[model samples]
Target: MKDELLIKFLLKETNAREDSEVTEWLAAGAANQRYFSQMELIWNVSKQLAVTSTVDEDAAWNKFKENAGQLDVQRPRVRMFPGKFLKAAAALLLALGAWSAYILLRPGYTTIESAATVRTEILPDGSEITLNKNASLSYQTRFSGNRRNIKLNKGEVFFKVAPDRKKPFVIASGNTTVTVVGTSFNVKYRNDQTEVIVETGIVKVRNGDNEVLLHAGERALAGKGINLAAQKNPDQLYQFYRSRVFIAHNTPLSRIVEVLNENYDARIRVADPEKAALEITTTLNDENLDHILEILALTLKLTVVKEGDEIILK
Candidate 1:
């Protein structure tokens, strides 16, 4: 790319064809991406300086000419172009315009993701969410005028919504929709099922014609081709990801392995499907994987085998 065209691109003064070219260049390689980032930083810094400093371009030009004359005397062999000075001044103005246009024309939504560990975030409406690993949540940049909406793209998320009677907080997860006002709840969407566990206040969960209203200490499970059902959640074991305490009350061994695999990225399998069907009652707190595995093997009367990164129980 030519220096002149690059300057124009940085200033957002490019035509449609030039803009497409710039986009292609940015996508070409990491080096081009880095160059554009540096240029954007410079443009932003220039905007900040323009806001804080009173610049008199005419006075600055006169001062520059004065300094240029002394430099010319020191290096008499060098030649100067009059158009170069005007181009430099134009570039400075273009940088300022670029920053203004970027703020106005850019369209984006807030997206949060958790990769290897759980993440917690607060939204514009003061709602809080704790995202499990590999989970993502996205919403519009603006959440105002009687509604706050977000989409749970993948994995589980625990929401604590701020009370807003006039404006409702809605979350769309797969085929199900969870609505609430001033409530705290956990919504997990996996394997074609959406599970909602209410921690406080009230929540309305819906899937097609099926719907259920849940209160504190209650939970609802919904899936395709099935109705939503509300039940008493006696054990708060689901919150173990955040509370560091795992409490299991007749929880299936398969369920335990599922939770462990989700959080720890471990590969654990039962030798027999019947073994996983067995339920166990136990409480583990901040325990290592091996220790927890040992306890499960002992309590369930199973043999634990370790091969490479995989764990198998028989």
Candidate 2:
């Protein structure tokens, strides 16, 4: 593959055909993959280093040269292929320094991940995002050009986007793309499906060519073979992560159990299939798992049984 084409691919400026060409070239051999990886590392590292306004390029180059000399002196093994090693090192240095200017002008992504608990973050554009447990979100470190783009890799997140009429806030999750201007919404992406619930302003959820505009109290689900349409949000259970409370209004026991299993460490199940259809109307505050189970058992006249790691309700 041509160096120009690979550079274009790295910069995401390639067309579909060019992209396919690079992909085919990369899959040809391990040497191609390693070469690409090295180039990618240099591009990423140079961009990171260029972000610092106080970076002294000349001083850094001198320091690296000094370190290289010391490594050669300390490790005699590198002397076996001194010509190849030195040539590679010289090429890396040239590539890094040359790309520093170009990479510095481009926008890079910053990723935020929530491990076992919900995490709140404020973006560079002053937008607030609360990520549920095990959720991953990535956005540009600096909102540039025409839009603020965010990617939801997995799990659920609530976005309180700041108003920017010129630059719309866009979130790409699975096959769904949500576009909004100054809106608060909850997005849950899981099992190949993406659900969007709008709380404040209007949100546009698009899957493939179909799109739905959702207002406050409205939501839409997009997935394989699922129609993109707005519907009234049935319950406020989506707010459980942010509010630390589960408020179910005539919700099925099965749905409640699903949410509980998601939030708690204990596994909950309905032993009787018929009992799973039982409706429950209650507000479960920040109570412990056992207490919540006890409340459910008392309300439904069901028996709570503990069998190993599972909590069974019959």
Candidate 3:
């Protein structure tokens, strides 16, 4: 394969796990490091080209025409104008146009998620994130390196950051910047306030004007400036999240069903009079839809099925 194709494959497959190998490869020798540096420069310049820049619908077509005319002259040589190269360039341009149209027509997508519970998100680095109830998070596909980047729209997020020391794990919400080498942490930034409490290892929370190093068992609240103090309850530091069990302890049936549905990915409702009247208490410790439904069935004596991920109860 060509050098460009190798780099493209690596770029597409880039993730936190690959970071270690890349770092090691970079440090293998000065030549390898130089190659990476050049590639990064190219990547940076390519991104700034803004092939998918958004503009008014009428203005966009005019701009595209102008942009196309401004392109450099293409050589007739097959090597310079290969069939594969033309196809790839055409595909890339089409994708860019589609992206611009999507941004122009759908303004709501300009919004990140809001007030979500147990949101499973895939990051640009292929790392998965799960935001808990009343949680919110957002991100831009384009971001600076040196870390995985995310903007917490609102609410809280539990991060299982893929390990990438070169690019530190960073969460920005309000004025707080939760920075970690490579670890798990929960950040809650709703309303105008921000809360960050680390679970494992350590994370540093820095506000717009304040950057303070925070250790494990440390929580930070950022508003106006970063206010970080040692966690008052160090013993049960992360009990609420660590339990991972959606326990509707004496909670109303209607509310409990909603919580269960949101958390365990179930769509169960009180189907019968007996089930509705029964105020059952159960724990869902990382239970899937089927497992949770089965437990609920045993608890409430209801029927469940294996209709893919969806749980339809009666």
Candidate 4:
């Protein structure tokens, strides 16, 4: 069979007559079937490599020849075909070599960044991660070997990890490391500090020599001059990016304003220090900045004033 016809058949682009011809050719002998299988593998691998990086065909051929020489002693005997078939087989071996080289030379981590809005990623092991705005995360493209490891380069990220006790899901955020078998949690790395909040299942946060295990509804803070310890999660504000709702359960005005500024890019502050301590329990759905501010003002019975570029409440 011609290489073009075989390639078209491999790609499923062949017409009915061509398909019949290729099917009949494969049925003729095991060697023909093996040749077609080799071509199919080469086509798939080359297509994948084409998207990622440029392939050096000459180098790949050379690598394939070198490896083929080593395997010749153990290689199975097959009837030889025309020079064109040999050339096609060489191309197949070349692609296989290129794929191997690509895997070996590729960077260890595939980094992902969120610019102005939240981003979601599903990992190879079925773990899901939601990155907050300006957040960065990195992980191996293929989860090989034992562990499923990830790095929270900066900003906040929530993880809903798939269960795999044998291969634990681990994340590195700044100096802290979080380890879990199957769990959902949030990790925020900002201002040289790493904070972890567990929403479901159990999470282990480690900083330097100190480590703390946190359960659902618990959190931990790790940074310079900070003791690593699990504490009760204050509010559901951490999930605002994912849920699109700012939930305050008797949350302080100061804390609420801080999150609002982070989420909406709004400069909101409590003018009176006493008012900053005032607590409010409310769920603010994602809406316009002005509308959210209006709700906050009404709930706190405070006046909202626009002074320069800042919004102040008293």
Q: TM per model?
A: 0.63, 0.67, 0.42, 0.66
**For model 4, the run of ten residues with the poorest summed lDDT:** 69-78
lDDT of 1 by residue, 81-184 (tens): 12333334424545445344333322235899998788999887788889988888986455633457778888888998999987788888888999887889
Per-residue C-alpha lDDT of model 4 across residues 48-156, encoded as one tens digit per residue: 4454443444454566645433111222123323333334544555655545633433325679999998999998899999999999999966564467778888999
Ranking by lDDT, best first? 2, 4, 1, 3
Q: Best candidate, lDDT-wise?
A: 2
lDDT (Cα atoms) of all candidates against the true structure: 0.74, 0.78, 0.56, 0.78
Scored by TM-score, the top model is 2
Q: Which residue pairs collide, candidate 1?
A: none
User: For model 4, what is the C-alpha lDDT against the true structure?
Assistant: 0.78
